[model samples]
Target: MSERTLLVIGAGGHGKAVAEAALLSGEWQRIAFADDRWPALCETFGWPVVSDVAGLAALEIQVAGAIAAVGNNAVREQWVEAIRAAGLPLITVVHPRACVSAAATIGEGSAIMALAMVGVDAAIGEGAIVNASATVDHDVSLGDFAHLGVGVHLAGGVVVGARAWLQAGCSAGYRVAVADGVICAPGTVLVVD
Candidate 1:
């Protein structure tokens, strides 16, 4: 199959990371960006910022796939849904240094960053971010658009709800349940109930 083109939605730090990952993978030939904040001025990682999401429809070019790189879960969720509704393909990205089990399942538009580990049967939901050095243990499930900050750890069978953000260095106990929209502060320790 021919290589696909990627349009990264968002032009912030996380978006730059995603663009770099895509470029390093060499799976896609063309990488462009879309953001509400226009005039990206210069390209990121050698890829130009094409247009804003509002202008996506007027491009007249085919975008093989797209990924929402927004950091906020709510915004990420919205953009992912918008792209999906537009009939555009959503793609997932895994950093070269990340380790993912064969039994693990990562949904579309999700990103597993450098040094992250996804264990057996762990299900990462669509548009979720498993940030650098984060760990999702066996049988854990992360709901759509969830964000796991750097060094965060989810023990076996843990369930993280939609749009949740587990901040950096935080660790949740085995079988812990984090409710939707929950924001665990940095360095927090969530004990199992």
Candidate 2:
């Protein structure tokens, strides 16, 4: 394949993690950032802050694809739409160390971080995030823009709705159905009685 350059939208902590995972995946030969902060935030982990949305317009010819690294689900979804509207391909980043079953389906623009485990038949939607060390059991469904923070655990058959944020260390019981836009506090546990 040709040398692919990935444009990461957002230059904050989450952006760094996404870029690092992309780097570890060895899918992109080049990576850069495009944040709203632009000039004031010139660099992130040594990668240049190419530009904001305006800069992205100029970079259309150079970047192979783009991924929204924003932490907020709504914001990320917006960026994803913008990137698509701009005619840039959305890229998915999966860390090499992540254990994803072959039967699992990871959607476009999603990120599966290092040490994350996605079991058989699990479906992760577009722009969703499975952070480091999270465990998604078999048959689980994570909706578009959903986020599973570090160490989050979801038992088999769990269905997380779109834009749901399961904070770090949160654990959900079997067949749990988390509603859309729900935000679970860190360490929260959802046990079905």
For residue 115, model 1's alpha carbon misses the true position, in angstroms, by: 0.9
Residue-level lDDT of model 1, residues 1-193, one tens digit each, is 7767799999889998887777677777778888887664546667778777777666556788999998899899889887877678899988888899999999999999999999999999989999999999999999989999999999999999999999999999999999999999999999876
Per-model TM-score, in order, reads: 0.93, 0.96
Task: Please give the distance, in angstroms, between residue 189's alpha carbon in candidate 2 and its true position after superposition.
Answer: 0.6
Q: Write the per-residue lDDT of candidate 2 for residues 43-156, one digit (tens) a residue.
A: 889888988965666673488889999779999998998898888999899999999999999999999999999999999999999999999999999999999999999999
Error of 2 at 154 (Å): 0.6
For each candidate, the alpha-carbon lDDT, in order, equals 0.89, 0.92
Off by over 4 Å in 1: 1-3, 40-42
lDDT of 1 at 161: 96
| Candidate 1 to truth, TM | 0.93
Error of 1 at 72 (Å): 0.6
